[model samples]
Target: MTTPTRRAAQAGSGALLHSLFRTKPVDRIVAEGGQGEGGELKRSMSLLQLTLFSVGATLGTGIFVVLGEAVPRAGPAVVLAFVLAAVTALFSALSYAELAGTIPVSGSSYSYAYATLGELVAWVCGWCLLLEYAVSVSAVAVGWGSYLNEFFDKAFHFTMPAAISDSPGENGGIVNLPAVVVVMIAMVLLLRGTSESAIANTIMVFLKIGVLLFFCAVAFTAFKAGDVTPFAPMGWAGISAAGSKVFFSYIGFDAASTAGEEAKNPRRDLPLAIVLSLAIVTAVYVLVGLAAVGAMHWRRFALSGSEASLARVLDESTGRSWPSMILSLGAVVAIASVVLTVMYGQTRILFAMSRDGLVPPVFQKVSPRRSVPVANTMIVAAFISVLAAMIPLGRLVDATSIGTLFAFALVSVGVMVLRRTRPELPRGFRTPFYPITPLLGVGFCVYLMVGLGGVTWLVFLLWALAGLAAYFLYGRRHSRLAAAPEGGGPPDSGKGAPAAGEGEP
Candidate 1:
């Protein structure tokens, strides 16, 4: 159905915010309960499956593609940059863990903001997350397309048309067919349900980690000490720049955080999942970076789509195409898997927003049989698919990093706000270093944001502003919190008195 008029939405949202947050405990903004009857959206996912979701979502084609871009900037020190990004991610993960423990909601940072900051801020937070998840899936799909082409030519001895393979803006290519196809497939899987996708995602994660491990082993054989001659050839600036670029790889930690509502024992498992995933991914990124740089000159690892960067290294080391073919095949599968998991994350975030009336209600329509938001998944898939098909992989990656960094900055700030306002609220997992850890997270995220080019920042700002406008026009008014009955708020919203939806603390 069409959402409320823009002016009405803004007025409604403003009124709702004033009423919801002004109270002592903010008890006037709970969500409508029994959304899908009694037993919709079954919690069939285990801790291991959830961990795979986070890792699979985060570890996709980014390393395969962006590493080339980052290596030139940091030279040998890009490894250090990966560690810095991981450290920042860890802090954010800690804050996420605490919030998840206390709230255990599906809205992620958006819900957190509503409970602590107010309604308007919560709407904006949700808007920013939209950018992070949707744009990220598009970026990963494009990256996957790049590697797919490379693998096809090297292993199958065939090449697709440039127009079908390359992005429209860059060069003269028309569309990226492979990227678009993968997005469509992911949408279908999401419509069927999460259980199946979780299984597929777990398999994909195994393959990606395995491929990286294999590459590390093989690349090390050709590793030469001379490659480290000018370790800091580009100095700390370059190192920091590379680190900033690589930071995009760690955005998946929140994927784990997003599963708070479904997780069994979110308090303990959420924190563990976030920290462990970050640590493990960091080690993989750093090791892969070291192997790539050591196997060849840091200066010559072309930052663009070098289809055969890994293959060339393998050829140089083993003097054969078989090893290169193996890497190529593994990369193709890994990229596809990343697209699936990341797209799944995007659809879920959209579903949460829609259910709250922050977006179109069409997204909230769950399938009777599958218990999944079929239309929402299809819409997200279509948008990302068109983007992947038409846009250059490199440009899409740049946009993805900006959206994630902005959202991360917001979450870090949210943590501090909660600490001051809701000291009484039970927090199961507090961030260890308090202000220090969160401050560092903010600092690191901002640093990475700056490393992105002027064009990227400009585009991100324009899109975010557009999202805010949309919220004011539509989401703000129709929010269930605004429609909540008197006598405090609703339970799901953390505004009403404790009841069925009010939930157990």
Candidate 2:
């Protein structure tokens, strides 16, 4: 016979285990659109606007600057590296498309995880996003500052003092004043509202595509077959190493899906924008890599100091001053847009987490007039500003890549879990081939993660540990779900609207 005390003990253990893995109700998240506490963000963004958001975020700072560093690591085989990174990106991207189309929520992978995997996993995913968005923006800002300094020296014959232009801990400088300046500028624009940010992103997307196309046209004119003859000189090890670093270039497309609430047609447009933007950016990255190496041998390419390598490649290829000058100028504009879009993503993820009472209520406070999370944006900006001023770009890029790969892998797994747990859930987009697609997504993400090197793994472990500590200290006890009535906890995305593919009328 079971004793009463033993029964109670077993019940207590079960409750503890349940609470540890408590899942947020998807219907509740979907219901918030029609009757949430704070006023909702405007749904003024069209499919085209959302697509531009994806491209604008992914195309800048990366293709413009990464080649100088990646080329030397992989020799001319960095082209294959870009292709490998693209395959990894494509798989995770498919998983993202399925979830974004299904949930149509602001939290991206974090929200997706909450609806399927449980709160603990959701918190971990959100924490990883903090690392991904913040570090990527800071790295882009540092790259922009270097390009800005170069533009000033060439166009104006003057450069900012190295003491302020370079990062504090590296390069013998006091602070990266220019990097901090760009972050502040983006902060101001976001506080204004989303509409202004969207418009700027659309314009910058066009400019970035046009400029990269221009570079390719000019570089091919100087293309020499001999330059690529010794391709893969460093072989597969080099290719894999550089692929890990270049993976950072593919991260920003998910930022488009983060705007699910403000999108005009979340179900139809979110997945399209995610896939389209990635395809566009991948094509551009490969062509530019081929053009650059064919014009200038990979062995001689180096990012020594702060020079903008693309602009240098253009100048050397064309043997003229104007082409390089144009490339540098375009790079400056392109990177600022990247900063704005990425910072917006960081804020929204915090806003979503805060709304669930995971972090703190302070992050949930939205501005009524602007329909934006003003306090959240400022908090993200302040922290990112400090990091940009202090850290080196190379280190920031590596850390960002590792964090993003982890979050992406989790999202891929979440897709498979949701399918098994809630097969009845309406999915606007289904990942083709089901389990295989998501499994490969997880596999590739893990492969690239290992390529990030041992140093990055140590830093990432420390970061993940801190997130777990914070969750237990505050998030667990105050979780909105546990506080709800006997059935479960609450808030949602589209007001209980049946998912587009979930047998909706």
Candidate 3:
């Protein structure tokens, strides 16, 4: 009884829905791990290197600069905010650990979403990851410039001119040259190869940890019980708001998961690295936050600049320039390590998406000699450099937090979906309490996302819209899964197979 026009409309709608929710098989995702353009990604990262990579990425800027910003909002209760953020991150970290052990792919949450959720959700997760990593590197690079200027003033009695050191429109800055310089430096190191970069990150991670401990030792010398009084001055609302803000600090704990294909023992190492790094980072952050608040009144942090908060705290605690100088030096190394590891994570995510034909093929083109994604690294560096040179840090940070929370929420959902759909799959690690843990992860992520500013939500919505446009325009048409025959995998590209030595742990 239906006319041809109505029948055609129904058919078109059905086809669109089918394409939107199509899930990629987990086995296919694993089998396609190392098949890139020129060569496969080399697996050389040990458990120590993987853990250090996450530590290197997570330990920067948030404690160094964001502490100052959060303190005014929550008073001494900023310490509680750090703990709350860590708790939020912990729930999701457990989910990430389970999935990383089971999947063991370079795509991180994006690949997990594809294997469990759908193509549309996978693209959205990947796009959010792009926002999280790229903008976080830019934000960290901006913080690096502040410390670099502090180091210059301390060691040489000189600082770069405001025009060249600050982002556009801040302090009359035309460009943040130091931020650009750091991004380029990270790019060069990434081109060298993953193992070489991890080695450098390990050294920097230890140095920064030493500096933070030194900060705590000196800061405690001036600790007063009075400063920590009235800890909940603004009550639970203020602590929750600050928790959302400080959540930016916890963004990089998943950096280890992005290296799933590159880890020497991904099944065991990825989960261990993820959980260990979060524990280590959380302890350091809580210790530093307590020390900072106890050494000085929370209100005073506003008078001092937030960009170089730790150095200023050290300066005040000791009434000496040398301590601040030491802190500044450590911050420069600390933040640069962040930029390096986060940017590496970004390139690998793009590489995975590219392999699925969701982005340009250049992303998956591994360098034959170095076994790194040279072109992908360069592209990411160039884009991040521009952002660091142009955008203000405050705008960059909140936008990054929202994107990260959204991605984390999706990852939590993915864990539950995979468990229900493929309970028989071998898992090297399993989430404790199963549905309850992942459900709490999703709940915490949503709570924080709601606490973020309305402007950040608007920015995230616009970003999601842009991703949808890109996906429909290019990704949907060229998707490998879409082109495959029914109940079959995509045709082999004949690039290369996964490297030997990968096996269940």
Per-candidate clashes come to: 8, 9, 0
Alpha carbon lDDT at 218, candidate 2: 95
Q: How many backbone clashes does candidate 3 have?
A: 0
Collision pairs in model 3: none
Q: Candidate 2's error at 148, in angstroms?
A: 0.7
Write model 3 residue lDDT over 124-152, tens digit each, in one string.
99998898788878988988888898899
Error of 2 at 171 (Å): 4.6
Which parts of model 2 are misplaced by more than 4 Å?
1-9, 33-37, 169-172, 230-238, 302-307, 391-397, 490-495, 498-505
Candidates ranked, most accurate by TM-score first: 3, 2, 1
lDDT by residue (tens digit), candidate 1, 459-496:
78787789778877887667666665641343434334
Better lDDT candidate (1, 2):
2
Ranking by lDDT: 3, 2, 1
lDDT of 2 by residue, 1-505 (tens): 5799899999999988788787877787765431123655667778788888888888887787689889998988999999988988999999999888877878788898888888888998899889878888888888888888877877887888889999876667899999989999998988888988898888887887888889999999999999998889989999988897688778787888788777777877888889998998999999999999999888768743224677777878878878877788788888998999989888878878877889888777777888888888899999999988987767646766778788899889989888887677677788999899999999988887776678788888988999999999999877888788742653433246643222221
Which ranges of candidate 3 are over 4 A from the true structure?
3-8, 230-238, 393-396, 487-500, 503-505
Candidate 1 Cα errors over 4 Å, as ranges: 1-39, 169-172, 302-307, 391-397, 485-505
TM-score of 2: 0.92
Q: After superposition, how far is residue 401 of candidate 3 from its true place, in Å?
A: 1.9
